[model samples]
Target: MPTEYVKRVLAACVITVLSISNTANGLAGDTKEYRIGLTSVIFADGTAFVNDWRTYLTHHLQAPVKFVQRQTYREVTDLLLAGDLDAAWLCGYLYLQHRDELELLNVPLFKGKPLYHSYLIVPSSDTKTRKLTDLKKKVFAYSDPDSHSGYRYPQLSLISAGIEPKHFFAKTFFTWSHRDVVNAVADGVAQGGAVDSYVWETLAEKDPQLSRRTRVVSKSPEYGFPPLVTQRGLAQRRADNLREALMHMSSDDMGSKVLQILNLDGFTVGNDDLYNNIADSIRIVEQGG
Candidate 1:
């Protein structure tokens, strides 16, 4: 064979092998089961919620899907970063902190908006506490320390008011979950608590008795809601598949039903810039101002 022709033939063979390898990898991704991590959220039971999410993803992706529940957002993030979880639903605070290490998958839309707030809640019967300042020198409950709406934003709100949570509150503790924060405030275990507004509203809609026991004393400005994220080096084909299934979850009957149960409008593509404000808040809090 001519030297030029031989070189062309070898290049073509190399391209063909690469193409075949890519296709095989895609096929493997399509058949591979995934384990997803979920942070604690309100539900009748964690097991039931996990099963529901598993059913939704398994049906939508047309593959086996398993969900692992973590008691705290930090645990979920740790599992995801350590490669124990294929993906996770993590709070925006943690997402921003580790944004460079992960890829944004989807952000859940609630009531047509992709943002939510942190609410400072006090017992309905407590007339003395009207705002965050009113809770001064009183026991305060915070959700996970890594939670945006639970801890970061609320701390910023208190800082903005010229009071540091640690100094202003008689004592502080973390409830680990927004629902637990609500329960603590309702049961008067804490004089006031900070919680995700979305979780509080969902509880209000589904379990009014628990919600009605508390009143919102203040609300932080809207912040990006928590998002589903995967490791940065995840297989592109697998990430694309999961993103597609989640973004279109509300367009079909089963998906729509699941959305209803989860109190979500649907999922949509997210941008890292959406959480920049959370980062700004973090900076302010960490600087003690």
Candidate 2:
């Protein structure tokens, strides 16, 4: 063969091999699923909403997205710690417990802020109850044991008021879902409940009947909203990509719709300081301060 003809053949063969290698790598990346664990406390009331949000994330991340949900925060936390999940949306109290093991990705914004509060709620019929102290010896419902808004804040609030948290309520139970906490109180199963203010406001907006049946006795001081987090040791590049997807979600049309369903304004690269108050509450609960 002529010299130029031989060189052309070699060049074509080289291009073919490079193309094959790139295609294989792309397939590998596409097949790797990013699992995200979501606790029930963060559950949006509608399943359709979750599915849409998952689809949006999958598109933006350019990978399959799996949302793993469990009955309790601890179950999801365990899965995340064991590497069953790549990331999770967890209660701040749970995040604080495993802060060293988890990487904070971003915090969802509610009403344009990275902060939310714990709401002390009671049946609308109970007008006499003014605060946690006033509910002494009354039954109480908590959304989850590991919940910052649903459990820890109430515990800390009672402790701060010089009341024995353990003995203050005649009975206490876990409703598991913030919506259920509202339901439990509305149905008179419990005289009062601690719930995420974000959940409460969302419910109040979409289902006025439920919100009308219950009343907010008080709202706890603002705490960092429950956050999206990844494994502590996830590759920096992968983590950054996931973080970028979330923080920029609001800019996408589908992403913005999902945020509306979630009753959130958007997301931001929240700071460690937003959760400092929660860490303090956790320490007090553990150390009996």
lDDT of 1 at 260: 83
lDDT of 2 by residue, 1-289 (tens): 6999999999999989976875686567743567888886563846798889888988888877888888888999999999999889998888889989998988999999999999999999999998888888999999989999999999998877777789889999998889999999999999999999999999899888998999999999999999988889876766777888888778999999998888888889988889999999988776664
What lDDT does model 1 reach? 0.84
Give all candidates' CA lDDT scores: 0.84, 0.88
lDDT of 2 at 133: 89
Among all windows of 10 consecutive residues in model 2, the one with the lowest summed lDDT is 25-34
Question: How far in Å is the alpha carbon of 279 misplaced in model 1?
Answer: 1.1
Report the C-alpha lDDT of model 1 over 175-281, residue by residue, as the tens digit. 99899999999999999999998899999999999999999888888888888999997888778888988887798777777788789999999898888889899
Off by over 4 Å in 1: 1-29, 41-45
TM-score between model 1 and native: 0.87
TM-score result, candidate 2: 0.89
Question: Candidate 2: global Cα-lDDT?
Answer: 0.88
